[model samples]
Target: MAEQPQEVDFALAAYREEGVWQVQELAHDVLENLEHVSSALRRFPGDGGAVGMVAYDEDVFLLVRVAGPTVRLLLSDITAADEWDLARDAVEQLGLPYPEEDDDPAPAGDLDILGDLGMHAMDMGVLIDDYDLYPDEMLSDVAGRLGFGPTFDDLVGLTSA
Candidate 1:
């Protein structure tokens, strides 16, 4: 575990209720681990459960979907486990071994996490493969495809007033 908690660029929970999408800014402390994210997400009354998007240290991002007792996760960079406790917890939850420091940066866990919401696994993979984009950018693109880009952008301060 790190002596200091990881810095979060942003942590948000998005869910749809009554046919409307709602985005909420999650507290930075939710980035502690998967359990915290899941617990926080359960508070939302989203029609299909709630989705959590957290970007840490600008090095990796974690997406968590909590519906009922089921929780699915996706970490943008598997190798991040080497330095981040949240990523390590994610890798463990996915039943994956920690990657070697020299291993290539790859996304791990449920690639089809958002399939039901309309972002297919193939497209998700493509977005993860785009190294040019930061975690926030990738997540913003995801929000757009899922029909809540503007709300996500505004919450993350990506939108100009």
Candidate 2:
């Protein structure tokens, strides 16, 4: 069984309603599983549904975009499934096979998850492939691209106060 992380670096829900973006901190419990995260996101009244961003132990990140009955996912590193339950769950949800020990670290699932929101699949791939950036940095970039960078940064303590 894959081990779950003891703590989540951060988990946030970002949504837009009435043409304005609302960013809020998600409870750590919601990071227990992808289902919980999705459920939490559904409670938001975003015009295009809500998005969940979670980073665990500074090692991996998960993105869940819920729009009505449709749920799209993105795992920053497919290899994380070997030791993280959330990553394992994400792999299962994406209908992907488990990664072999030798598999190189790479992103798995919908690269186009945020395409309609302005971050194209190609760009997302490039961002995820950048090893220098931590999960928080990557997520910050996503929020910025989606027009809510500063808000997200502030919420996650990425901004210097």
Candidate 3:
């Protein structure tokens, strides 16, 4: 069997600062809890709102958006719902039932992380359902939708070449 990846791979947090996108990353331990992630994101220094994406290797992905005091979340798989703290917190945030071991890793919860930035909920659903794409690609699509594809790609060191 392939070795399982660590629960949290990496997290990217970005927000518009003075008309430019400012991006930063968080450690895995920080993602093991929600309040820590919140505290970290709030320090980005931006009035244009903040958006973040956390990928748990090939298993799952979590998207978080903070606009002022409101925080929104999107988890890629509900089957692995209770497997990690981020997923567990997401379930609690949505008041969702924890998925069992036999459950399929279907995209769960909603993807309104960028609704205020112009990504429609229905469109996010479609992107989330495109199983052919991996977390980075899906997030890249999201970045594109949010008008930060290149900037985000650059921050994450992803190149289309």
Candidate 4:
């Protein structure tokens, strides 16, 4: 049998320190874990590049690319206990399929890391969607509808309000 390294678990414990559960910290930890797992998995059969992030509802998730698609995994959340239950129920209602097998290696599910950071749900999508909440058409339409002038910036901002 091979002995696994204890160092990663030690770092994970440190990263998830109690009362220090900021969303960014959580996301960074998730990402680190993802990189670790993906790299380890690379020594095996499939590609090794799974990634993790926190999404709109204080949800921590793992995302893995498979067959050219991104799969999600819901790891943890800082939201109400019932929130995850509700999301899972909604997904079942929507007929989304659960992962097929452990070896299949797909992402878990959508998580609400955004809510953990106190941002609106749409803001979570903005963060993951490459920081562009308003696409070109949507931006133009909203600007026209609200009679607002166009504003442009180099990078999309994700600061908590």
List lDDT for all candidates, in order.
0.90, 0.89, 0.74, 0.28
Candidate 4, residue 161: Cα displacement in angstroms equals: 20
List model 1 lDDT by residue over 1-161, tens digit each.
Answer: 44435477888999999989999998767666789889999999999899999898877899999999999999999999988888899999999998997999999999999999999999999999999999999999999999999999998889723
For model 3, which pairs clash? none
Tell me how far the alpha carbon of residue 147 in candidate 2 is from the true structure, in angstroms, after superposition: 0.6
lDDT of 4 by residue, 1-161 (tens): 01212111111111112323211112222333344433332332222222222232222222222212333333322121233332343234335553333333222244342233233345434443442332322222222222221321111122222
TM-score of 3: 0.85
**Deviation from native of the Cα of residue 4 in model 3, angstroms:** 10
What is the TM-score ranking, best to worst? 1, 2, 3, 4
Q: Return the candidate ranking by lDDT, descending.
A: 1, 2, 3, 4
Structural similarity to truth (TM-score) of each candidate? 0.94, 0.93, 0.85, 0.23
Off by over 4 Å in 4: 1-18, 21-95, 98-108, 111-114, 131-161
- What is the TM-score of candidate 1? 0.94
Off by over 4 Å in 2: 1-5
3 or 4, greater by lDDT? 3
For 12-97, candidate 2 gives per-residue lDDT tens digits of: 89999998999998886776778888889999999999999988888789999999999999999999998788889999999999
Candidate 2 lDDT (Cα, whole model)?
A: 0.89
Using lDDT as the measure, name the better of candidate 1 and candidate 2: 1
Candidate 3, overall lDDT?
A: 0.74
Error of 2 at 143 (Å): 0.8
